[model samples]
Target: MSSTTMEASAALDGFHPITRQWFTEAFPEPTRAQTLAWPAIAAGRSTLLLAPTGSGKTLAAFLVAIDRIMFGLPEPTLSENKPGVRVLYISPLKALGVDVERNLRAPLAGVRAVAQREGVPFHEPQVGVRSGDTPAAERTRLNRQPPEILITTPESLYLILTSRSRDILRDVDTVIVDEIHSLVATKRGTHLFLSLERLERLRREDDPQRRPLQRIGLSATQRPLDEVARLLGGAEADANPEQPVRPRPVEIVEAGRSKQIAVTIEVPVEDMTQLAQPVVTGSAAGAPQPASIWPAIHPRLVELIRGHRSTMIFVNSRRLAERLAAAINELAEEELALAHHGSIAKDTRLVIEDRLKLGQLPAIVATSSMELGIDMGAVDLVVQIEAPPSIASGLQR
Candidate 1:
């Protein structure tokens, strides 16, 4: 660790005891990425953090933001009726938004406890998610009573900006673009640039007295930092004459441990007789070869699960996730394990996540649904059944 890391670690140590306790309870220690990124983040400087998944970048970004909101310089008093969004957290996927909300509850609860003990007027910062799945009534309520922090997807953010709820963004003090690298090379990011420009214009128009909203971008992996910075800083023509055109500073923190990828390449025997046995009988007789060719794959999967106390098996698709999980359950019969994927309902996902965190689940066979920053217990090892298409996806796993 360098001097900067030491200072940051100390700063993190100085966080309200309850908040620190909450962090430890949730995740025992900060990842190397968190240690390197927190100081700049806590200073209110716009930053782009690049670190692999399972490295705690999500909590690092929000922890600093929440600390600033709760303990940084106080804001000037405004009317209670002046309803506006203070923090805008945008993700590319609605599922990511749901995961973010669940992850944030721990720190939010800690903040509330601190306020209560200190005798400060505790206003629990309201956080709500808006996406295609959000109900009409909830959307209407969000417009009428915007939360202090709004967690949403890029498309949903664009929709909110263009809709009647545009005023909700007028007072946004910080905008966090999560999974930014996921959008950078695509048309969606190009479109999002326009939205961000619109947001800056809105902030200037609505609250001319305050400074522009701070912009922070978070990603798992980014190469050629300068190019990533330029993409995030908006096109050259948009640079303002009055304000210095400084690209947001980006910090890349590699994981403490090198990439943990356990790959197993198995060539199936040419015999179609023994390998053709059905692992589960609920489905059609010849339904697309049961995804994983379970009879050949199950034994290896069972071996991996039995060997490791905690393991995550990333299958090719959701259908495979369910199929492999069913087969594993049948094989083990008594071990605590489950199938996890997007097809499962939100409530079920939360339950599985909780069980994983509690160390009650020995292993979970999942798809990309488990790839995001959900607190799914401690994974001792990750088994990639097939090679991920890109370095980004592989790093995330």
Candidate 2:
């Protein structure tokens, strides 16, 4: 390898002896998205990684942040609190906020273990999640200890941007918005972009280097590449705040190439009219057919799950997710099936997520909650209860 290639390899190969080994062992080859995305991000550029559902986009964004932490965080005294937050991860869902930590466990642990063996103090990427579900005590404690990598929802991020402890984020150099397609077209995205600008303002106020925040957006679907790129990189600062706003530019990495997508839409093998009928009745039919129609398909759902090592059964809404999940739980009593939706209690949802990742559960009946690329290990199958709202949503799921 040339000198420059060797240097880039060393930097991107985890930036530490332990991390490099972890990368080699865990992923022998970088996915297309990671291959193109990492160098741009590491070079302090904003990027939008548009890849297929399981293309390792999350790792592409996270590994660079992890590298910075492993090699850059200052060593602190035992009594001192960890350093200021430098990477803020914004997930549209609260469930996903905590899921990022689970997704991060291996690289962080592996690299840290290697450092410990070599007597190096690795401290940069202490991660924490803050959301509505985050307890007051936990929130207070995190603010005091200030994790360098913070995973939070847009709402929680707004609170952080406006709260007294906002300074905890003043040093943040990177902001990762996962599942950007879910938010980019809505008011949530608007609020989030404003929050991004606010985050920029906070950093500009105190950072000695005065560097702009490096943004990495992971998306399943997006159109008009330049617009999405501009959206990824928020409005630029004005020499005068009242002047016309200029937006930052971004490098769009399109990894939506030919890949092996094995999707089979299955229906009942026989005696299926009952499964098609809406089981719940408030009107001619209670809610949508699929939500109310789950009873008839309960057997089939269970059978499909039994056939696969791990299955993510996608439904449309929280209501349907809960109802079908409950019915599936009863039908597949022997199988460890769990309900996952926005309405489910946070603790229960978290437990289900962990179970799915560990392969302890065969199936999880979920709504759009499972749509985002929050690692659940290798899912063998995906069964959507009904058609998704749009082609984009379907592609994402």
Candidate 3:
């Protein structure tokens, strides 16, 4: 099957058989978001898709990009081995980039299968992730040998645009900004805007004859669509007299109903009595506790660890994360408790993530590290020791 034929067949039915098989295997079925968003994306239109968490919005955005890259380009001859970066995927979190890489393998495999049947020298489109934790050797290699698709966080992208390797963005044909809502209200987004402008400047300089790179913005939630459109492209996006301005369409797919979540709240039984004891008793004045009550809150953490089979506990501070883990281990019956946060070594975190994915870890006490899109399989329960400051942070948990 030629790539062109594969795309045409999929276009008639909204998704290719291979892709549909992969999707069914990785996830149960395409959500409502995927159903509506796929066509607009397949048409090569710039799009802003809005849907709630756990709605498969990420897959919706990437499937189109993968299909286009697979089908839109001509089959490469034996001599064609190198292709510059074609897709620049900007994720808000480094963890999400890793998760996206895992999710993309299935689709890539599907493309390769089709290419092989056609007797084309199927070069698997190289996908690389760049982040703060990306090893020094990989970073250096990426500069010399750019991937067909590059996944990175905004901060990493900002650093790349400002660094000597800025030229890598020159041939970028598409830019997908994942989690745009997370960046839109902060200085990070402000900095990213300038970086996009810089990228546009570079694209103009390097490929003056080519059309501007297609911009696709992905978000779980956003309001005031006009502002986001301008943020993606400048004010001149709608009114570039020289070029025809066809604004990308935005689509929203709400989950039919909220999934029923099981939540449990734990409180200290023994410590409550001590806390109720007065600071001053007759002639003896008790030593004063710290003004902040986090220490007092520590004893209540054990119930959180033992309450669920697979759990993630969000802590406000890294020190507290370690301390709570240590405390939980001391109190836990099965010795399955482990601390996970940014302060922990990267190698250790990866191991913990693996264990959690396999359901080997009974309880993994973590800060925001486990949040975002790092797949730990389906967690039976999530315990928030403290209230998340914002709804967005809470959603990630």
Cα lDDT tens digits, model 3, 1-397, are: 8665454345436555445544556554466677666776766666777766667777777776675565556332112454467789998876678778877887798667755765555346789999988899999999988887899988898899889888777777678888787778889998887787778777777445556556777766466666786677542343457786554344333333365766666553445556655454344556654243455555455565456668777777788778777777766545666888776666777788778878788777777666765666657767777787567777657
Cα RMSD to native, each candidate? Answer: 5.6, 4.9, 5.5
Poorest stretch of ten by lDDT in candidate 3: 74-83
On TM-score, who's better, 1 or 2? 2
**What local distance difference test score does each model get?**
0.72, 0.79, 0.70
- Give one digit per residue, the lDDT tens place, for model 1 in 1-397: 8776565457577465556655666664677777777766666666777776667788877886676556555453335676677788988866678888888887898777766776765346788899877899999999888887899887888898888788878778778888787678889988887798788777777465556556677776756656766666553234467866655454444444566465656654556565556455456764543324556677777877888778888877888777778888888777546888767876787677777767788788788777755555578877777677567667667
- Give candidate 2's TM-score: 0.83
- Pick by TM-score: which candidate is best? 2
TM-score of each: 0.76, 0.83, 0.80
Kindly give the stretch of ten consecutive residues in candidate 2 with the minimal lDDT sum. Answer: 73-82
Evaluation by TM-score, superior candidate among 1 and 3: 3
Clash count per candidate: 0, 0, 0
Q: What's the lDDT for residue 248 in model 1?
A: 41
Q: What is the lDDT of residue 174 in candidate 1?
A: 78
Instruction: State, as a TM-score between 0 and 1, how close model 3 is to the true structure.
Output: 0.80
